[model samples]
Target: MATPIYEFAQIPRVDPAAPARARTRKVRAAGQAPTVGVIYNPRSHRNLGADFDCSLSPHVHIAQPRARAQLPEALADFAAKGIDLLVINGGDGTVRDVLTCGQAIFGDDWPEIAVLPKGKTNALTIDLGIPDDWTLQDAIDALDQGGRVWRRPIAVSPAEDGASAAGMSRVAGFILGAGAFTKATQAGQSAHKLGAFDSMVVAVTGVWALLQSLFASRANPWRKGARMRIGLGASGVPMEHSGHGDPEMRQLLFASTLERLPAGIRPFGALKNGLKLVAVDQISRRTTALIPLVLLGKLRGGLRERGIHQLTASHFTLSIDDQFILDGEAFPAGDYLIGQGPELAFVTP
Candidate 1:
């Protein structure tokens, strides 16, 4: 049985507040002739599906479908080709890589991104309404028709201290987090060789890892639990220290880009162009609480009053016990602090 949502009170609240957003911004509408770059990561399941529908797109200036050691080369090639929009055909990791690559090669004036939900858990793409089953022909057709595409702002981590200080340290397109949730994702990825592309499978695997860590991992998780000292914000304001303060003790601190999670238990205002911040202390209760409310795709029986779907934080960081997963890919610097890494900018479909 899962624990209760109230258990989250065990988590210390950070000064995280709602994201302050102005009107949505757009770089290129559908009709504009935006030169496209296709940096497909063939290794991920999402990019390999449906006969490589992404690679076959007529609009994109295609490069080899892989994340090279020195990714800047690929971006240089695309930029040299004058590609205006960079279409990423992979999961969250791939998307993150693309952002870094863009920063390295193009700096702040980089191409906008269009994602193909070719990842295991396409939480962001799904939020963007990029269908689970998309065809290249359809996308091309839509672009030709100048379909009404939606645009959303991607979050950027506060500038860090380094050669690439202005570069993105972290960019959350769909979700960013620390704590047990990150550990769970890292653990689940250990079995990546035996994993599937389906979101349900990945979620189950992530949960398995969470349980394993709770019960068996060598880490001292139970006594102290996973806690991080972070500051969150939105609309460019700090949301990390007050009635909406940072959590003193949290098992999982997550900020999501979309309103809904699995089974359509979307956070409020996610679809309305905002992010959601949730700090979790007891997974069992959260699981239970969110489960019943997930009736097909709508909330029911007093479940809707549980939490807010929209939250914002500008400077959020954590001290974690395990490596966290950004989107789906795990990093080598997984164990250390990534002072504001990975930035995400979006493109309308």
Candidate 2:
């Protein structure tokens, strides 16, 4: 049998001459129900093949896309219906797929988004301050009564001249990581199998990563890191090196538009908001020993000299020799552009 090639949904082309549609907030009149569209994922960790309840409201619309290829049509239908709220009933990966597909239909004008933490890793929900037990009913009620939090997902695209840039498309996601962070993400899968999710998985995999990096020799994959180059801002200025281990290699690179992280870890140090990134170069074991404190915001002094670099940028370009983790999935390695998507209003209790 021939190997199957899976095709994901692509963003449809829009006419340049067409006027941009205004995405004004729809205010419901007294006793009026808002139009809602939900994208539910049955394969999410918590969903676990269970059927989603579809008898919520007359105005509610639900589409459970079994694969990513079905998202575009579903979102197009929602856009045609002029839904006031867009509910994503899954974990981070589902959110990534929904947003990436919706870009063509919704563009910068998106309906208020609501996320239910129903995945093995709900880091985005932690940033949104959503409880794990939140339901569609809770999200619906909050549509009118709850507050709105503004967030921008990180948008990643292949660089025009990148090796694999021929037919790659832009993807929207909340978290992006590479190098040993990629290895840690792989370990998180095992943690999930042991009944760990969210913060517990973070705690478990984090300790393992630290131990592996601490006790192992510099030649270990955890310490050797991946070879990559980062260029900061629109001008593409080369990122400064801290003169630690090999200047061309970094042990880890983590970037996100999220201000808060699961387990309350502060990898970006004092930097908050916008697109924040932390790059770690191979360092002495003494500095590696301080990883816990560094994540706890306890050690902030002389971090640059210690081979830890954290900063916020409007955008950045990454060229890496290894695959990177976005949300929970991995993307091929190559030159790529990373930036923030439009600000999206998220309903929160």
Candidate 3:
């Protein structure tokens, strides 16, 4: 069977009023091994059908959750053990599921995280400068010797009206995209089957998307975009439209807390850090032709006037007529509040 991308979506809604468990880092004695917990996904691109090596010390605990329902139990068990390091041995989807389930358990006080880039798209690891060959032993050793990189995952919650009666259903992830981005993600999957992974997949899908937009008519999905309203910050200020094409429809919407993407693409231009976003209006083919330069960080000036809007905000709201993607998983179309999750420390060499 194929790996299910919607595993995180199966997680039940968490109550808003329930008191979150306070997570505290485990302190090891001198010369003692630090307690480690690993959430290993057997279905990850690199780990498929391979048995996990069990030669490690007893201090390292590994959990192979076959479904999303088992993630919370595994994470809670880790918390009870006072694990010093939480290693995610999978790609972005696995990271999203772990972080989402861990919210109720770890709250904002999480153990130092170490990600082994064992998936097709390891965007978070790329941002943390983790090498593809990083191993579990390396992560344990890095706990003492390696540097630390701080990052915040983007937190997405349903709008008040669309929320569950108990509370809003929230999911945490690094990359969120809609409009043409959703189509590109679908195309990326096709590239994966052709044996293209990581940056190569990005290049393949990006070039394909650009070509489609350049040659297709305005009625095409690539050029027509999606109908969505983007509100900036807490005040819900309307995002300015450049009067390029249809003011009501945007050609693309991409948001992320990660600074470095897989292909070194800079969609946010000069705006880095915080919650940065790029919203493109239903621009003309002439403007669509400049997307490469914009993504390369070369076409910076007068972007807003040319139908490209790149800005940073504490939070943003989205009301869309079509489905959006978060960490390669599709979410139903609805209103949502997007903000940054707690700052997490990632172990890096």
> TM-score for each prediction?
0.63, 0.93, 0.95
Model 3 lDDT, residue 213, Cα? 92
Better of 1 and 3 by lDDT: 3
Q: How many pairs collide in each candidate, listed in order? A: 45, 0, 0
Q: Which parts of model 1 have CA positions greater than 4 angstroms off?
A: 1-34, 46-60, 106-112, 146-173, 187-196, 202-224, 233-248, 267-272, 282-310, 331-349
Write down the RMSD of all candidates, one decimal each: 10.0, 3.4, 2.0
lDDT by residue (tens digit), candidate 3, 18-124? 86676656668888899999999999998885867766888899999898788888999999888999999999999998988888888788999999999989999
TM-score of candidate 3 on Cα atoms, chains taken together: 0.95
Question: What lDDT score is found at residue 6 in candidate 1?
Answer: 13
On the 0 to 100 scale, the lDDT of residue 222 in model 1 is 29
Residue range 30-124, candidate 2, lDDT tens digits: 98998999999988889978886678777899999877778888988888888999999999988988888777678789999999999888999
Candidate 3: lDDT over CA atoms? 0.87
Per-residue lDDT of candidate 1, residues 1-349 (tens digit): 0111212122112222322112122466756665677766666675453335444545567655333344567777777766656677777666656654454455445555567777666766755667766644444444444233343324433323322322324333456655655555655556555675446654665556445544643244521245445444322232233221123545555665454455454434333344446554433444434533342435433332332223454344444544444555432222222233334455445
For the record, the alpha-carbon RMSD of candidate 3 to the native fold, in angstroms, is: 2.0
